[model samples]
Target: MTAKVAGIPMILCALGVFVGGTIWTIVYSFTNSKLLPKTQWVGFEQYERLWGENRWLTSIENLAIYGACSLILSFVIGFVLAALMDQKIRFENTFRTVMLYPFALSFIVTGLVWQWILNPEFGVQSIVRALGWTGFTFDPLYNADIVIYGILIAGLWQGTGFIMVLMLAGLRGIDQEIWKASRVDGIPMWKTYLFIVIPMMRPVFITTLVIIASGIVRVFDLVVAQTSGGPGIASEVPAKYVYDKMFLSQNLGQGFAASTMMLITVAIVIIPWAYLEFGGKKRG
Candidate 1:
């Protein structure tokens, strides 16, 4: 009772900030507000423009590509690293620290680091050319065709380590008795992991998926620092579009509409899964 009493302020703040702020954003999203808040209502006019914009379309396509690739690669790379670390290899602590160091940096820093690394003149391309290969070309940020992948590279480098840590924790939580039983049953190590351990780590994997999915949906900082939605808006994501519209372009209505769409998209993806995750557990 005392704990609940002490939580009153926090509860009020959540209601005032998150719920209230969300309602305000959604309300204004339907208005013809620009630069400053106006009483004029737009009635989905901003949404029409949002859907018709080529740049917004590009952003969605790029987001889809980034999200899919990031999910697959993050899981695979993180699990592989975790599995290797689980072997109790030599210099385990040192290797883990080295791998996780990137995750400590902010997305902005990661983007800038990758920006320099992907620079055609002074980065990987230049180094390879300097090594007697005069015709080397590998600059994803400069090429509109694969700029999103460039940002994805930075995203993966910065994020995969954290995923590895989470997976490692999950792996460490497995019962040693399971390993003993598998060994007695003459089960192959790979088969045991694939069929037994992974299945048992379902909760951890679901949590990791949620984290990765949310990050993919709201990806903005890396794109800003690395490519700034270029070369030619090739790396734009939904969050960036919302920010540009609201702050840069002073199109508050449009920005609000975009943000609302993002919210809906997230809810669409999350609500059903969450119902199954928590609701089914409660029922059982």
Candidate 2:
């Protein structure tokens, strides 16, 4: 009873700050609120305006491209590195530290670093050209069609290390007896990993997916620092759009509506996971 009483403040804060604020944002999204949140309700007008914008649609496409590539490549790269590290090879600690070092830096730093690296005149392209290939062209940041992929490279560099560490921990948790059984049965290493090990790591993968999905949904700082959604708004994302609307354009209603849409996207990802994670167990 005392513990429950002690948690009351936290519960109230969650309700007021999170739940209440979400409700307020959703309600205000329906209003034609400009500099201030006016009481003039405008129904779905803001949403209609939002969906009508080409910039918003482009942002969604960029996000989808980045999200899909990041999700697949990061998981693949991380898991492969973890598998290699699990071999208990020489200087494992040094290799692990080198891989994880980038994750210690903030997204802003990662973006700036990669931005310099991807610069056409002074970066990889220039270096390769200097090395005798006068016709080398490799500038993803400047190209409107491939700018998101450049940012994606930076993101994977920063995030793959963390995912590798998580996967390594999951791999370490598997029983040694399982390995012995596989070995005794003369099962190939690849088959063991693909069939038995991956299935056992379901919870780890789910947690990693949620973390990556949330990051993908709220990606702003990285894009801002990297390209500022540029090469002519080619790499714009939903969060940056909402921020520009609210703070830059001073269009409160539109920002609120965009944010509400973001919330709905998050719910779409989380609700199904939550049901399978908790509800299924309860029913069983």
Candidate 3:
């Protein structure tokens, strides 16, 4: 009883902070606030402005493309890497370390490096031109329609490493007897993995998907560092839009409204996913 009483203060303190911050944001979202709070309430005006903004809409579209591509690419690449590593391949430790090392670096640094590499004049395109492929061009980073794919490529480079590690850990926990039995039954290796191992790894995959989705929702640094939503705001995302309005534009009300919209959007998407995942687990 003494220990429980001691813990109560800490729990209460955390709850207080969380509730306070949420209320502050909610209040700000409904006001005509600026750099500093003025407490002038203008309910739904900010939200209406945000909904009517073209840039905000563009940001949402870009985020959809970015999130979908990144998630799919990361999962496919990570699963393949995990499967190959599980085969007792040579220098497995070295391969694993090499695959995961990119995640250790900052997204700012990663984006800068990729920006340099994707530059058409002096990067991969130049190198390819030097190799007698004069007509070759690798300028996806500059193309409005394809710039998001460039960001996705860089993001996947880091994110796939995390998924690889998770999948590898899941693979390692599988019983060796299953593999032996599959071998004894002369089951093709691909069929064994597809029909047997992949199903067993579903929980790990779902968890990884959740983590990736959350990362996508909060993605700002990489977009800012890489493209700065440039090439005509083709790569704008919600987090970047919120930051620009809050800090750069000093439109606090609009910023808060955008943030609130983002929070709602995330909740809408994640609530169903969370229910399906956790609810299924409970039933199981």
Strongest candidate by lDDT: 2
Q: Could you give candidate 2's per-residue lDDT for residues 21-114 as a string of tens digits?
A: 9999999999999989998999999999999999999999998999999999989999999999999999999999999999999999999999
Candidate 1's clash total is 0
CA RMSD (A), model 2: 1.1
Candidate 3 weakest ten by summed lDDT? 261-270
For candidate 1, the TM-score is 0.97
Q: Residue by residue across 1-284, what tens digits does model 1's lDDT show?
A: 99999999999999999999999999999999889878689798989999999999999999999999999999999999999999989999999999999999999999999999999989999999999999889999989998888999999999999999999999999999999999999999999999999999998998898889889999999999998998877888899999999999998999999999999888877887798699989999
Could you give the C-alpha RMSD of every candidate to the true structure, in order shown? 1.1, 1.1, 2.1
Question: Which runs of model 1 end up more than 4 angstroms from their true locations?
Answer: none
Candidate scoring better on lDDT of 1 and 2: 2
Q: Name the candidate, 2 or 3, with the larger TM-score value.
A: 2
TM-score of each: 0.97, 0.97, 0.92
Error of model 2, residue 145, in angstroms: 0.7
Any idea what lDDT model 1 has?
Answer: 0.93
Candidate numbers, best lDDT first, in rank order: 2, 1, 3
Give the worst 10-residue stretch by lDDT in candidate 2. Answer: 272-281
Query: For residue 97, what is the lDDT in candidate 2?
Result: 99
